[model samples]
Target: MNTSRGYLVIGGLVLAEAALLFVPVAILGAAINWPESLDFAPSQALPLIDGQLGQVRLGYGIYLVYSLAWVLIGPAIAWLALGRDKQVGPLFVVAVGLICAWALARAIGIIRWLTASTFLAETYAAATPEMRQTIDLIQSSVNAWGGAIGEILGVSLFTVGWLVVVSLIILRNGGLPRILGWSGLFVAPILASPVIELFGMEASIFISTLSIHLWLFAAGFMMVGMALFGKEA
Candidate 1:
């Protein structure tokens, strides 16, 4: 495809992904105080799930869609990059690879909510104290393992890697506004802030979330403009 057409597609996808973030955020945030709820112990979390299983499932189901869409954006960005140069650079390859890993890890993290957590919630609701203890152990393990893959690996690391690489490419290529590129660079470290949790420090994920949302929103519009009017300084 031509560059304008490519930008159109990529821009639209970026904007859609940015907007789609709100669905799960709003739904799960209301249903279970999520994201924060993600950290709740089984005794606390299971009850919320038991009380609002439908909302929890619905929120996560939409989240699954959002996460899977992340995969598509990778290839779209790769396509745009390749169209510009007619060859893939190491950065492009790395960006696409990280995006794929991000999508998969996020999906794995979300699947627990839809499938395993539902069962655990139901079992916990009726379980005796001993059984509840076992359930707690199982749920905690799931949260730790899945959280590591999804939150730390996918959201924090892989996504940040993609942003940094892509931003550098944009800065060099002038495919989008240079300001957008700088903004991406500015946001990349903040996006990776959640990774600090791995070191036993509390991550202000809210700040990261706000930074990324603003960056994506800005980039999305810039891309659409580039599509409509061609590249600009």
Candidate 2:
């Protein structure tokens, strides 16, 4: 397909992915009364975990969709990059590879939690002291090694790489607004989240969520503009 059609199609998919995430967040935000941090204590998670994981399951289901969409997004970005005739530099290749790999990691983390961790949480809520200890050991092991560490590295690397690569693309190619390119500079703190957490600043989670969503919103606006009006370019 021609560049314009390519842009239109990929752009729409990105927007749809963003909506898939956004809508669920909005609904879950209300259902759960919108916890400030995405991380919730076992107590906070207990209600939904007990009831067929009603709201929580719905939210996680959407997260699964979000995860699946990321698989598409990495390739979509590459399609846009190639359509714009940008150099597919080593950095570009590395960024895309990391994004794709981490996308899978993210999927695994979410899926594992949905399938196992929540069940463990339900068990923990009911188990006797001795049983609770076993559940804790198993749950903590899954969280520490299976979920937390993997997702931390995966999210940090892919997101940081994503922002840098997209910034470079927008700055170098005129396919997108340069202001948007400059905005990509905002990803620095997100990249530093691991270090930030080490410093006891858990606020990095909120910052990362806010900024990335804003970035996606801005990108969607620009891309949809291209789709509707600038498709001939």
Best by TM-score: 1
**Candidate 2: clashing pairs of residues:** none
| TM-score versus the correct structure, for each prediction | 0.92, 0.82
lDDT by residue (tens digit), candidate 1, 163-228: 888888777776567777788888999999989898899988778878888887887787788888
**Residue 5 miss distance in model 1 (angstroms):** 2.8
- Candidate 2, residues 1-233, lDDT tens digits: the string is 76667666777777777677776677667666544424555444444455545776777778777876777786566446443666677656776776777777778777765778778867877788888767766765666554454346666666667777767766766567677668877764565475455455554555666676677777766766776786522
Q: How badly does each model clash, as a count of residue pairs?
A: 0, 0
Off by over 4 Å in 1: 81-83, 230-233
Candidate 2's C-alpha runs over 4 A off are 30-40, 231-233
